[model samples]
Target: MTVSMTTRASLLTSLRMMVLLAALLGLLYPFVVTSLSEVVFPSQSRGSLVYDENGTIVGSALVGQPFVGAEYFHGRPSAANYAPDQVSGSNLSPGNATLRERALQEARAIEERDGVTIGEIPVDLLAASGSGIDPHISPQAALIQVPRVSRERNMPITEVKNAISSATENGGIVGQPAVNVLKLNLALDEQARGMP
Candidate 1:
């Protein structure tokens, strides 16, 4: 049986429709989604980065890293060792002896530096966060290290506490207060350097 011109034209039309649909769904859909995300959530689309007063990008507000010196407020322990690409948590269980040993050493070091009892160490201060990218710390975590930071910087504890308070996030309806480590650390650097 020979196909008519009309039947061939109909098959060609169906093929064109399939190609158009594939282009729209596969290419245009992703482009639209990306454009919308950039428009609606720009900071997040850009990695929620924090910038210093010099307009230099310092780091993301979502991920945490270390501040080794006594003058800076330390962030939570990271299993990735502060590498963004290597984000991960230490998988040691609570009952793991190595985990306990590491936690105890960390707690002891914090206590000695802060002049606080070992019991006062915040759990977050000793444990690596899941994903190892928590940029915020509990207010309690910030406070426990305040004395040490203040003493090292030669600033009053009250001033340091005030800074922490200013850095704190509202309870979000009876939620506990929290501090963004990046912002807080930036503010401390500014204050210490007397930058406006």
Candidate 2:
């Protein structure tokens, strides 16, 4: 078998190009972006962690925590069960029997818990967000839970409403307003501490 020099040169050139491109895309690109993000958005770059008054890390503002207690505001229904590593949606189609059954069960539970009719329950509270770790819920969702949280926490309805108002993020013209469940619950705890 006779090997041509041109073929050998072409193989060497291709190998060299592959290595250069791989290093640039896989290594250099990630390094530059991470470094820039750290400098430009320090808190967000660090996962937007939420801290307690004792300076202990509690949770990330970006991820939802499951709060089943009556005293705390609950976030969206997480198909992943609020596990970041298992982040995913139910992936069931709208007409899926399992999805409908689950939604019906949740609606009935919400009706009992929040004293609201099934018609009034916000869809966001029934359906899990695509990421299954949404930290925020619609303002309507938060409001419906206010009575239950206020009753369980022994805080006045007015004060709980105020807490919801404070924790609610106005989406402005770009998006609909949302309430951060974790922040609202933490703030309620702080308010309870000060109450006689």
Candidate 3:
């Protein structure tokens, strides 16, 4: 009788411990972490979404996306087709013939489209970054595209130049102040609205 009672008590104690651990580790822990993250890092917890002038969700500053039209400043070329879920790069060697040819083709197209005779095309504009989802382009890349956008949008070059400057991040601080292409394009839209 004593042995059976001890066995039953041990089993019940183990069962209670399992239930308590499940409740604490599984339920309580996740809830607390999630709740705290929502309060502390709300925008990041919600995908870092950026809004348009009209308060509509445009895209996330965290992820790189493509501009649909040519009138806008273009971001780095992507290897993953700019799919939000498929962030990646071409991952080709520097000497890869296919990569070289692709870069050449991109440079040719950009030159023709922008009506510029480039002695050397910007590497950022030609090469895909490690993530290939780089929202920012080098300031030089942005500047090269300026003439085309200004001509297409019929906005003054100065306004477009200022927009690019405004969109650049950490100029000479952390790294070369790269311009976020989407942000510059948005600024251009806002600036153009104020034009005659």
Candidate 4:
């Protein structure tokens, strides 16, 4: 009888500990972290949403969006199709034949589309970023597409080039200099409106 009572007491203690820890960790921990982030870094913590001229939410600066209109600069290729919930790298190694094939195929297509030879292409235009949904591209990548966009909108090349330059960021100590493709494209659209 004494042994059974001891076992019952131990089981009750374990059950109580489990419930307490579950409430503290499972319920409380997440709430604390999220609340702290919202307080400390409100805009970034909420996905850095970008707004259009009409106050409509267009896209988040945090993630890439696909652009195939030929009149805008394209962002890096996304493995998750620009879905924030599914964002991830391609996970392909340097020796992967599939990786090489995809790169080569993209190179050829870009050359045909942009009317540029293979050697003149910038590396960023051919490679996917680590996040796969990077919204920024190298300045060279943005500049190279200026001619195409200018011709499409019938705007002077200088104006399109200026918009891209204005959007390009130096990135400072965090990363390499790059232009936010979405912002540059939006500026291009604004300029294109009054084009001849």
Candidate 5:
């Protein structure tokens, strides 16, 4: 088969364009963006890792960790069980028997544990986040658990509430207030240790 000159030129032009776009978009663009992000937001660029007083990494500020003990405020119930590798929702329909049963059981547990009536429990406490690894809970969710956390930690309720307030990220105009459970717990630890 004979190839036309115009066809040959067009093929060469297409190949050159593809290589140029690949380099710019796939390689150079990512490199530039990553570099800028690292410089602009160091902690977040590195996973927003939370550290202890001893400079040991405990967890990331952006991901949730389960805190079942009474002394610590709990995060959302994770369908993925807070596993980063398995971040996902249960995908059960809202009316599914398993989902409803799980929520009811959790509500009862929270009532007994937090000493609050079922009606007082926040929805965030009973349901897992869509990512199933959300590090935050509603501020109301954190507040409702204050009694249990204060009693378990042997700390004053005011102090526990202060810690929650410190950990809370106020949504301001755009979103609802949320609390990072892991940071709050770590702050509680620091407070207990008399560290700033």
Candidate 6:
């Protein structure tokens, strides 16, 4: 039995629809997503890098690293060993011995560097952030290290605290107060130059 002309035409139309849908869903969709990502979130799409005034890329504000010297305000602990590409926090349970040991070591190091007792150490300073890529430090964490940063820069502690306060973002809705480490550090560098 031969099919009617109308049925043949409908079959061809269905095949064309399949091809168009495949191209749109399989290819066009991904391309559009990538383009939109680049446009809408340029910094994040490009890895969230922090750049210096001269347009040189410094480091990413996302990941925490060891900034042990008194001149710099340190960030939260990271299990990535400061490796940006390997960003992660230790997935240890609360009673994990490794976590306990690391916390103790971090507390000791901060105390030694700041010439303060361990009791003064902020919890954020000793504990790793969940994402290990937190761009901001808690306000308490920033304030705790202010004296050391001021002493190393030979600037007044009050001035350094003021800078911290200026760089901080206040609690909005449900968020806690936080200071962007990159911005704070850059401000310190600028202040060293006596720039207004």
Give the whole-model CA lDDT for all candidates, comma-separated.
0.85, 0.89, 0.83, 0.82, 0.90, 0.82
lDDT of 2 by residue, 113-174 (tens): 88889877899999989999998999889989888887898878999999899988888999
Put down candidate 1 lDDT per residue, 1-196, tens digits, no spaces. Answer: 9767665557788999999999999899999999999999999998888888889999888777678888888888888888889889999998999998988888888877777688877788899888887787888888878878888889899989988988887768877677988788888889988985
Misplaced by over 4 Å in model 3 are 1-31, 194-196
Residue 68 CA displacement from its true place in model 6, Å: 2.5
Each candidate structure's TM-score, on Cα atoms with residue i matched to residue i, is 0.82, 0.91, 0.80, 0.81, 0.90, 0.78
31-105, model 6: which lDDT tens digit per residue? 999899999999998877887767888777665555666699887887776776777878999999999999999
Error of 6 at 118 (Å): 2.7
What RMSD, rounded to one decimal, does every model reach?
5.3, 4.1, 5.3, 4.6, 3.6, 5.2
Clashing pairs in model 3?
none
Please report the candidate that would top lDDT against the real structure: 5
Whichever of 1 and 5 has more lDDT, that candidate is 5
Higher-TM-score candidate among 3 and 6? 3
Clashing pairs in 2: none
- In model 2, the runs with Cα more than 4 Å from the true position are 1-9
Better of 1 and 4 by lDDT: 1
Q: Model 2 lDDT vs. the true structure?
A: 0.89
In candidate 1, the residue pairs with backbone N, CA or C atoms under 3 Å apart (3 or more residues apart, or in different chains) clash, namely none
Rank all candidate structures by their TM-score, best first, as comma-separated numbers. 2, 5, 1, 4, 3, 6
lDDT of 4 at 48: 90
Where is model 1 more than 4 Å wrong at Cα?
1-26, 174-176
Worst 10 residues of 2 by lDDT: 187-196
